[model samples]
Target: MLHIVNKSPQERPSLDACLRIAESGSILLIEDAVYAAVKGSASAGKLAEAAKKHRIYVLLPDVEARAIADRLVDGVTGIDYGGFVDLVADHRACQSWL
Candidate 1:
């Protein structure tokens, strides 16, 4: 399964909710949710913990747009739109945590 979170952790509980229920799957952070992908942000620890259980990814364009391209957590993979499309195709299902 793939979980897509598009909201900021600081602005909503979407990311938290997604992380709480997420198991051994994949998580793709897009839009404002990319803020949580930062290396030392508030959700950094939680994201790092989640990475141990699930594959974590962030939209490369979003990270660049937000100007945090260089601060991504160590294990979070940055992907482009084509990669996002590939992920959707690779997974059996996708749940968007808006």
Candidate 2:
């Protein structure tokens, strides 16, 4: 499965909610949710935990737009739109954690 989180972890619990329910699948952070990929951000700890069981990914455009592309968390993979499409195609389904 593919889990997409687009909300800021600072403003909403959607990321946490998604992480809790996500299994050994993939978590894609886009829009404001990309902030969670920053190594020392408030939500980084939760992301780290999520990484233990799931493959974590961050939208490259989002991360670069936020200017944190170079500081992404150790295990988070940064992907482009093409990569996003590939992920969606690779997974059987997707869940959007708005």
TM-score of 2: 0.96
Best by lDDT: 1
**Tens-digit lDDT track of model 1 for 32-93:** 99999887789999999999999999999999999999888899998999999999999999
Query: Would you list the C-alpha lDDT of every candidate in the order shown?
Result: 0.94, 0.91
Over 62-89, each residue of candidate 2 has an lDDT whose tens digit, in order, gives 9889899888889998899999999999
TM-scores, one per candidate: 0.97, 0.96
C-alpha displacement of 10 in model 2, angstroms? 0.2
| Stretches of candidate 1 exceeding 4 Å from the true structure | none
Error of 2 at 97 (Å): 0.5
